[model samples]
Target: LLGRVDDVMLVSGHNISTTEVESALVSHPAVAEAAVVGAADQTTGQAIVAFVILRGTATESEDLVADLRNHVGATLGPIAKPKRIMAVAELPKTR
Candidate 1:
């Protein structure tokens, strides 16, 4: 009820909230902020994709990405894990 219907993603026939995924990503120590979206996937119907801003003290690396994915899988379920995670300097904003 907090977010709009558009914020909900039909991933593998399961309704997953973007906010829920974002929260899970942000819970990681290295993550400062996160945004999640569902992308077209032939296999799953929709795949979770994430863009993350790292904490000032955190460095971006392949290992860190793997750790973040593992963290989300552990926090939520494996189905909630992001298919891809990209480190971004900033997220686009709108008024």
Candidate 2:
């Protein structure tokens, strides 16, 4: 697997890798990079939340968010789609 064991998330009894979701997000032309996490959810056990950095030519918008979600769903699967996707200026990194 591309990701470590710890990166696996249990969502609705399905095992999902954060890297897989990240890959799906980055597949879109507008997305430069992506980070995904599993958040506690009463219904699905865990919901996927994504933080994405857009390409310089792209802008953040509600329409873009919807499009990204749909793109993920189509690229991966509906179950793999993120519950929420937030646009961020940059991702935290260690020196």
Candidate 3:
């Protein structure tokens, strides 16, 4: 379903869905939740950027960033891996 939508981003000519990236990010043990957005890029057209909330015990660091990237890469391939991953205290929500 995500693969067929106009909301899907074209990254280096590859279709990338924000839903798929979020799913991949949360699959990592350290991640509790994830939100993904597409950022404009001259080379890739759009780049995947991820904001993540980590589990209580997980510490945010460069090593963790690399690990999460590797985790998503393993699950969704290199193309689906986030170009930027940032740990956030919370994701704003609207009811």
Top model by TM-score, which number? 1
Model 3's number of clashes is: 0
Tens-digit lDDT track of model 2 for 1-95: 26477598899999988989999999999999999999999999999999999998798898999999999999888998899999999999759
Give the clashing residue pairs of candidate 1, or none.
Answer: none
Clashes of each: 0, 0, 0
Write down the TM-score for model 3. Answer: 0.89
Model 1: lDDT to the true structure: 0.92
Q: lDDT for each of the candidates?
A: 0.92, 0.93, 0.89
Point out where model 2 deviates above 4 Å. 1-3
Per-prediction TM-score, please? 0.92, 0.91, 0.89
Top candidate by lDDT: 2
Q: How far is candidate 2 from the true structure (C-alpha RMSD, Å)?
A: 1.6
Stretches off by above 4 angstroms in model 3 are 1-6
Candidate 3, poorest ten consecutive residues by summed lDDT: 1-10
Q: Decide which is better by TM-score, 1 or 2.
A: 1
Cand. 1 TM to true fold: 0.92
**Model 1 off-target regions past 4 Å?**
none
Ranking of all candidate structures by their TM-score, best first: 1, 2, 3
